[model samples]
Every structure is written in structure tokens, then in C-alpha cells.
Target: MEHKNTPIYNAHSYHTKVPPQGIAPCILHYTDPGDLILDPFCGSGMTGVAALMCAHPPAEALHLVHDARLGPRYAILNDLSPAATHIT
Candidate 1:
């Protein structure tokens, strides 16, 4: 069977964090195989996850402003508070 798009779910505990399902497609479409995505106010790092999925490997392929607060680590992520950063 063919797989559909990524499902949207509560991936993180944030008030207004975009889901990876929604952001991934945009990231892949807009950027090439190797590009740098910087989400300065990366709330939940959904963008980072999206970036990672697009490149899919070797960590060095793609880059995201992936702060430790966020799940991925390719770019520098920043948040207003530890809670926000932590959640991302």
C-alpha cells in the first residue's frame, strides 16, 4: 500500500507549535537536498524535524537551526524560556 502524508499530532507540548506533518512538505519543496533552515524562534522544532526527514541521514546532509531545546541538532535554536526550548 502507498503511504500518505505525515499525520498531524501533538508532537510537543506547546501552545502554538506547528506540527511536523504540516511543515515537512513545505521544507522539502522549498529547499534543495542540502540547505540551511534557521528558525530563530523555533518553538517545538517541528521545522527541524521536517528538515531532518527531508535530508534523511548522515546528519551532515541538511541543516536546521536545531537548538538542543528542539529534538534535532543541525542548527542553532533559540526560545524565550527553558520551557519553550525544552519542549522543542
Candidate 2:
């Protein structure tokens, strides 16, 4: 992908159909190898995967706030939606 041509904006993967290709360039430009990056939503962990592929170790953390009964900040949020999680 052309780094300069692609638009940089906050958008969800489901709506834009643009897989997280933009992540690689962003990481390459601003961060060094082994630098930590966080993707709070991490729909499919694509940003983390890209970081790994680029030789940067990534620590992925997902925060799911949809279930009010479970309350926020619950780690179970990560486990509840396996289908929505992909780590490459």
C-alpha cells in the first residue's frame, strides 16, 4: 500500500473494509523494534499482528464494554467474544 496515498483516520474495520494495513507504516515511521503499542478495541488484533510482523513485539489488550452486567474493566471481556478476536 502507498503510505502517502492512503487516508489516515479513526475508522472501524467492519465498515471501511480496509484491513489494518495502515498500521505497519505508522509503526515503521514512528516506533522502533520492540516498542510497545496498544490497541484497546483490537477488533481482530490486526495492529498487534502487524507489529509482530514488523519485528516489534506487541502486547495486545482488548477492552469490551458492551456487557454492562459484567461491569467495565473486566478481563472476561477478552474471553467472552472469541469470534471477534484474531491474533493473526
Candidate 3:
């Protein structure tokens, strides 16, 4: 997917931060609705944001096949740093 600099991505700063848009596609590809995703080293909690997007995808992301699942997926994000967890 093309990289889009969205507000949520730009809202914070982290050394290993990833855009939620980039991660959403992967989440949508690998998991079904109501599925759980675990990110052990979730920097800036982009994975959680992505999982939320999969559940309530924007109009632009309606084309993703996982939307057929008719439900929202869940995410568990954890980071070694307290700052990262707060950023989520």
C-alpha cells in the first residue's frame, strides 16, 4: 500500500514508529474479524491502530477482503517502554 502521512501517524514521535496504514493491510490479510493480534514490541501501538482500522475500516479501505468478516478484530499491544504503551 502507498504510504500516506496521516494525522494519527504524525501525532507522536517514536524511534521505531510505523504508520497504521502500512500495518493495516497486513492485519487484514492474515486475520479474520474477531481474531486477536499480539504485538510484543508494539512501538507507538500502530498495530493496535491497524487492528481498529480493520474492524472499522475507512471508506478507502473497504476493498480489503477481510471486511467480509462482519466484525472487529482485537489487538494486544505491549512495549518494553512505558512511554510507548502510553502512546497507544
Clash pairs, candidate 1, are 64-75, 65-75, 66-75, 67-77, 69-88, 70-88
Q: Which ten-residue region of model 2 has the weakest summed lDDT?
A: 68-77
Residue 6, candidate 1: Cα error in Å is 8.8
Model 2 lDDT tens row, 1-88: 3332333323223332233445555555555555667655655555654565454321221121121121111111122345555422
Query: Can you give the TM-score per candidate against the true fold?
Result: 0.60, 0.45, 0.79
Best by TM-score: 3
Cα distance off (Å), candidate 1, residue 69: 28
Candidate 1: misplaced stretches above 4 Å?
1-11, 56-74
Clashes of each: 6, 0, 0
Model 2 stretches with alpha carbons more than 4 Å out:
1-17, 56-82, 86-88
What is candidate 3's lDDT per residue for 1-88, written digit by digit as tens? 3544778888888887777767776777778888999999998888888898886666445565544454578999888988888888
lDDT value, residue 45 of candidate 2: 53
lDDT of 1 by residue, 1-88 (tens): 1122334335446666665645655665465555678888887776777666664422322243232122232455677778878865
Write the number of the candidate with greater TM-score, choosing between 2 and 3: 3
Q: Rank candidates by lDDT, best first.
A: 3, 1, 2
Q: Model 3 scores what on Cα lDDT?
A: 0.77
